[model samples]
Target: MRSAGKPRYASVMTDPADFSQSPPQEAAPLDEFSLIRRYFHHRQGDTVVLGPGDDGALLVPPAGQQLVMTQDTSLVDRHFPADMAPADVGYRCLAVNLSDLAAMGANPLWFLLSLTLPEVDEDWLAEFSRGMFELADQAGISLVGGDITRGPLAVSIQATGSVPPGLALRRDGARVGDQICLGGVTGAGLLGLEQWQAGQRHGPAIGHFRRPRPQWELGMALRGQASACIDISDGVLADLSHILQASGGLGACLDEAALPEDPPVLAGCSADKQRALQLQGGDDYLLLFTLPAAQPVPRGCYCLGQVDAQPGIRLRQRNGAVGALTVAGWQHF
Candidate 1:
């Protein structure tokens, strides 16, 4: 199920609509407020009692539920290529943050944007708004309020969601004997980046990197079934290590042969490199979680291993030998 080509949000109406913008043209530079009024303001969801245009947006929580909030900040040349399309920049920033809500098993509600641009480019702003709103609409999340100012190119989003008071998924509840699992394969995100850097315009890797989907529905399905949950923002080994450490320094053993096959784009790569890519590549955005041994794992999830009382990760090779596995993954610093 590789999604290839421009993301669904790529084709948007040029006419005024959700977060409408007049056709781009030469105009006087926009002041901060003018910028907000044109590109950042849009119809908010029901959760926003009063949105954008006030001291602060007033929001109401759902009855019998608690709020789940998360934020992610991305920068040009660091999080994305310096010359990436404004539309893709908008979609990628927000979509990645929504994955956090999914990990918490929360229902999408509203979000706030804090954008910094080096210049007020009307053409860029129009495309950016359309891209952001397209994903926002699909996720059932609305933009309530935010800030915009002059600075380097940057995108920050604070996504808010609701979950039944006691049922939010977390990373600390996993234990020995729980089966470790993943919603999908890895390496695609990094492969897409390689494709982009290589100047290929369209392919599975390009689509995966530019517009990766959050595993929201699967997360919701795992609310009661999963013992512990997290999304793969860092590589799986790194993110899974968090679950292990949080759950009291547990360990796990993975079956090498049981790992999902490499994405078709990686077929030309060597076997060892393929394994490393699946384990260490970042940005796949798949949910990595654990379930009780006796419980049936959800469909579409690959059961990679079983949590153990041991202190570190181990890999069970196809021939039956088990060896210590070093847990290395994406480093924030």
Candidate 2:
């Protein structure tokens, strides 16, 4: 197994596939405002401008640019384990949304959270709020306003941020011959979730899934340098295909040998199976980006492959064999 410090994309390994045979029990819903006040509200600094309890959140935009907006929702059974820690759930809910803003190279300003629970537990809400605030504090974003409703356990967050003029990274910007780059590790979170569900005791992999560390700083750094960018929310190959499709016939060639690998992952499975898992698993919120081939790849960026005129995504294996990359990842439909 490789050291944990190595790039996650490069290390490839597989593990025994296990899934929960039955669903976990659910939690009852509780008070809306108290829950918000206890967990999702508050701010660390003046960047918040407007804290929770308004019609909408107000934030200061960059000197000459417009604010970018993104909203994401995580459900109890679908998005997370019903029995998972409330604090981790709260933190992940906010972190994933912030990741989207990061991909756009936006400085987070304020956010709105709409939470629905069957019945709230004071202790759960407290811990959850603490986790959410801890991460929000790090990003300097504030919770402004949102609604609370009675429903199945669900957490929905809408985040707003700002970036310099004409610099927000988007899906439609990749061009043929652009170099493909990935920021940070991938697959650890998905593998972690799988392990946790299979009765594996808590460890680093599970922690990666529950509390993902969004590369906000790296996202900010890539703002002007990357021509196209997208957070790997679904899966690496699947998300990268969005860039290709948007670029009108532009394709991607992913270098399988160059992807970072997780030590635990390598320790768990055969090399071939590991490669398959790495290419298909999701919940890795790392950023996938493209830059001009002529420009030097920036620090913290991994040179995965390049944009080709071939019109579809392909994987270049270690032995020089090329094959079609799967579009499998998380899917709602």
Candidate 3:
């Protein structure tokens, strides 16, 4: 029986013995298209000429601008904890890649994701996509295309952005007397890692590690103003060293007194640990750049030091003593 404006459906219950004569029914839990629709699919944005479908995507790069691309990989227990929320993992996977584009003073446009999971978990995918797409939308980036598969938990994102020609920031323009600047403080990510490893998982440190904000706008604002730039993916000291090496083997002197320190998060930590977190720890993802001595540093950035013709990094302690840095920074190898 059917009601007005309502459709009627019939239920079919087949016996095992009669299955040989009937057509087969789908038994697989979820297909790829279904998963994509339920999770990653969203309305197209301005930059998307054609969004996620078909063999590829069409993106309209801003006219008269260069396309900048960067990719980042996150693995279970390597980039994040095994017990970390899927949402946080999703957020960081994109944040790190955005940091790369920011270092080059690019405006985010679109991204592609390649995700691998142990199995199909709808709930996890939903949460993950929520976190990832929310940030993408906030930055006006379109979800262009991607691939999903079964494997150990891992995520890789390739992000693309646009920058005006000849105005992109680089690491080789540092000059003597240029000011070394930081978009924000460091060590919060390391503090978060320490707390996670020590079984204390909820705190500001953990929050910093799980959800780092990329300084995209600040980078864009710095394009013509900054001489050399890099995002602190590794620790500040190490990443700054990269600029030094790139700029014809120059050097820098950091004023320890000016560096931001989160004492409460680092409370009860050893002095060595504090230094390591502040200097050698990685994953901060903040911007580090050099401005000409005559230029005013943009708001929300801290002046940390000055570039020098000397060939290594030196830190002037709060006690007025200079210390030689033996450890350059975080090393994967």
Candidate 4:
């Protein structure tokens, strides 16, 4: 059953447009090796002893540093729309993974992409690679090695990073009296996703949904300063509970009046709606960490509250009423 004229790794021949779902298409048969060479293969860092094309990556561990690795998968329709641009899908795949490294106070190093695609289209590959490498170049990480196989569209990225021994941020280090902090505003991510799904093409909310900036530099800077750190991929209440529960059953009392309100993208929403969005939105990849009360807070970040020895998270209202912030964020289930 050999095709005498095709290369060993070449897929069955067809114009990429012939396959149905949603996308821009190009004329070229799907060829595995050619796709890898054109898209994922690139010059790597000096420490990469061997990169793509090898069965596995060969990397040199940094002196006195511990490696941190995290993986995330995005599926079509589940994570994003099927018709979403290829470039957005590619960029988001890496950004989410990098956010994990940020939460750990680690610096970007290299990443492996396990990409599953329905078919290989030259234009799709071009845009996808452009978006992925754009961030990789900016973040100083490089593509190492991974596998690509034909299947339902999905993008899974495993990112590797490093930090000096005994300095990595974690969920368990928070303590009573530590100040709860936010890297930036939240709620825009949900707004953006709503707008995108409703067919609105351009706006701040849509932009935030498409391109979330991982708080990498800030996370790195917080090393040895913050007590615990976690990215707000889930909603604020959900992610904060993670910090609290992990820190020996600690709790926090947040100042409701202190949270930044109605960011420009959310200006049209009612106050209650805005609060729910802030507390329940997912994909706000900002870093939410706790710091000592005496430590100088970084500029552009917000001080949300203080960790407590109590058993649950609560909020202090402007009028002095206290209530529990018992709510779920995003559940993969």
Candidate 5:
């Protein structure tokens, strides 16, 4: 499934393996408001009562529903390569924030972009807005308002969406007996990143890295089904631990062999390194949640493990021996 030029998968991974073959290039150097008006000012729908040109934009939340909001930021090199395509950067900036809304089982409505550019490059801004709006339109999201400043290249997006009152998925609602599920394959994005770092620009892994499709539809479907939910921004072990800790000391057990493995992206890697990336690699914006055993598993989702009574993550090896994790995933001190 492709929404606005980005792939949406029904299985472990979505396929649309195309990307830039060249290394990230330097940005070419623009007026800020002129750029915004030229590219960012797209039309809006009913949800956005007032669009992007005022003191503050007015939004009309659907009646009988509560608003769910989330924000995420990406910095040059820290989050993505400094010279990566501005279009990919723009798409990722909004997509990641939208993933947060998806984890909460919300239908994304509007978003605000706060961008810091070292220097305003018209070409970069055009491509960036193109990618951003492509995903936004596909998801029915509107760019309500935002700010642009001169600084290091960084993007922070604050997205707002709607979910029925009392029905929003939460990280703290998981129970002891619920099953742990993954929205898509992890580590592919990391694989993409590694390839980019190695100066290899185009491949399956880089495609996944550059353009990640958020599981918004699946999230909406999980509304009453998922006991607890979170997006995989910081990798499985770390993000899953957040659910466990939030759910009041509930632990989880993962079957090592049960995890999804994709050959094209992970081929040639040692088994140990493969497992480590799957367990600990960050930047894979997939969803992780808990569901009851009786509920039917949604298509495009994998059952990785189950919530347990104990308090920390444990991995059950193929030989049936369980071991504890000293380091689960990425940490941002």
Candidate 6:
């Protein structure tokens, strides 16, 4: 933690006799350039074609015919808490962008980050850089370059990846009668947010909200089999709409009974509310893809619905009454 009026890059006195062993004292503020030099520059990796100290980054493309690109932004008080751990924030800021690449069936390659902070806290920056480097190394992606600006707390990351030529999964490939399959559990992140807002301390459900591991392997496996693919960032119903409209199709028969529910979510809400959250809540980040009805769904995936040529989405209840499915996900406005 950095305190008010401290230099962001000040030397730390680690000896207990030298410094009080109370709560860690915050570091002093630093200028934008110094902050970057200390935390964002010269990371140990060879994939970085252009390191920090420029307007943008340059990356070496994999020896392939196609490339995939995606960008994601997280805002303070909007995407996360102002006082949240800097390490978690750094990890998630990059993770969400990587999820977009996974949806396109692209291999993790390189990334650039842009950070805006209200103040420069050395301790916070150290932890944040550690978190970003840890995840990037695990995923085999390099931090090429980025920028730091003084402003309200916000973090934005842009990631670039490679995919085999002409094989990247897209939204327009879904066809009539394609079966909708979902990877991993849905609604866990949303339920996590609810738990956090309710003042609940650390738990598995809430942890999902803080750090989401995108299904990179599953995404690569879906490269050729999936007719259409989209990560559930804006909730299942709303994101599915992108595939539906792009494919010029509609009326997916979502079996409410077939939807998977995380136990923590089920324990927190009633059955009806749980169903609603699963359908409308956002930030699941799991892959929702469509494949031919005759194809076998990969293991660990579930059949959630079937595509139709009808004009709107439909939900089939246990009672057998069908109605228009509501898209009640995230609203930036």
Q: Which lDDT tens digits does candidate 3 get at residues 1-333?
A: 001111111012143223123324554344555677778888777778777655788877788999999998888998889888888888889999999999999999888888877766779889999988877877777788888765788898999999999999999999999999988767878888878888886877788888899989988999899999999878888899989899999998888878666467566767667777877778888899999999998887889989999888889989999977764566665
Q: What is the lDDT of candidate 2?
A: 0.76
Best by TM-score: 4
lDDT of 1 by residue, 77-172 (tens): 778888788898888998898899999999899888887777657899899998888898898898888876556778889999988877899999
Misplaced by over 4 Å in model 2 are: 1-35, 54-58, 261-266
- TM per prediction: 0.89, 0.86, 0.89, 0.91, 0.89, 0.87
Q: Local distance difference test, per candidate?
A: 0.82, 0.76, 0.81, 0.84, 0.81, 0.78
State how far residue 85 of model 1 sits from its true place (Å). Answer: 1.3
Q: What tens-digit string does per-residue lDDT give for candidate 6 at 283-329? A: 88889999999999999999998999887788988888888876678
Residue runs of model 5 more than 4 Å from their true location after superposition: 1-31
Per-residue error for 85 in candidate 3, Å, reads 0.4
Q: Report the lDDT tens digits of candidate 5 across residue range 95-167.
A: 8988899999999998988777765467888999999998998898999888776567778889999999888
* After superposition, candidate 1 runs with Cα above 4 Å error: 1-27
Cα lDDT tens digits for candidate 2, 174-251: 988899998865777678878888987577678888898887788888878898999988888888888888878688
RMSD of 3: 7.7
lDDT value for model 4: 0.84
Each prediction's RMSD over C-alphas, in Å, is: 7.9, 12.5, 7.7, 5.3, 10.9, 6.6
RMSD of 6: 6.6
Off by over 4 Å in 6: 1-33, 42-46, 54-58, 261-266
Predicted candidate 4 versus true structure: per-residue lDDT over 1-333, tens digit per residue: 001122322333343323332233454444555567777787688879988776788899888899999999999988877877888888888999999999999999999888776765779889998999988888899898888766788888999999999899999999899999999888988888888888887888788888889888998999999999999998898999999888889888999898777688787888888888887898989999999989878999989899999888898988999999776788898
Whole-structure CA lDDT of model 1: 0.82
